[model samples]
Target: MPSVRTILALIASSVTVLGGALAEPTVALPATACTTGAPMTTAGYPIPYYAQATPSTGAFENGYQPEPRWAGQHLVGTYTFGVPSPVETGFAYAQFKCQYYCLNQSEGGSFFVRADSKVGSYCECYDDLMDPETFVNNNQTLIGAWNAICKEA
Candidate 1:
């Protein structure tokens, strides 16, 4: 028979191994600061607005305009022309805007634009899309476009 000390040692070893396996894995938090590495460009409108008057009737303009949730957030850019698939096209446009316009124009940080309701023709920008605090405060979740464009940031 095993001695009491030997049994206690084995039980302690098992608990240690089980505790490590059962413990929640540590998740790597996103960086608090990030840079897009794109040169700053001309600062345009602070928030996205209809560059042109709202069209009377169109699939893209369903009279639904997504307003900016963040105050003093710069309008990185707008994507009016969307391909057949709004999600894919929006994502691509987001990447383009982030790389060329948002990174350069807006303060160096994370941002993303996506088509929520409007057809492929309309897209809006959300600055600090990857910030955890912003998400918690605004009750906003990171969209796929953020992953496509702002993941680096």
Candidate 2:
């Protein structure tokens, strides 16, 4: 397990950048942790968990617009195009305060990409998708584009 300080350090160093500009605001992001009792992923990966609390800013939890979805809840960014996603920086912003924070946020669970023009590493599970920065200097996690990466485990 990663220490909270380690996770926060990853967040700070791996913040995404666009044209060399930090896309994710310096707002306070929370520490996320998950554990699985049974065998986890078929690949032996970490199971996901939710840290249900509003940060300093970003979308609300479980509320979508132009559509009703997700545990009868939705967030503010769901309807608005918050950032240019799927790219390193855009994914950072989304993960930082992604309208749909996790797999449960959006029904599609992927969308809000950084525009097809841009691209970045798309990790599916573990902290790789949700937190990204652990291994990247400027990685981002795009939403609403899991069709290519999603599959039955």
Clashes found in each candidate (C-alpha, N, C closer than 3 A): 0, 19
lDDT of 1 at 84: 43
For TM-score, the strongest prediction is 1
Give the per-residue lDDT digits (tens) of candidate 2, residues 17-130: 343584646778543333222322212222222222211233323321112233123231233333453345554444333323445443323223332233432223222122
Estimate candidate 2's RMSD in Å.
Answer: 22.4
> Lowest-lDDT window of 10 residues in candidate 2?
129-138
What tens-digit string does per-residue lDDT give for candidate 1 at 86-135? 45545454444444444444443444443444443333343443432232
The lowest-lDDT stretch of 10 consecutive residues in candidate 1 is 45-54
- RMSD over all Cα atoms, model 1: 15.0
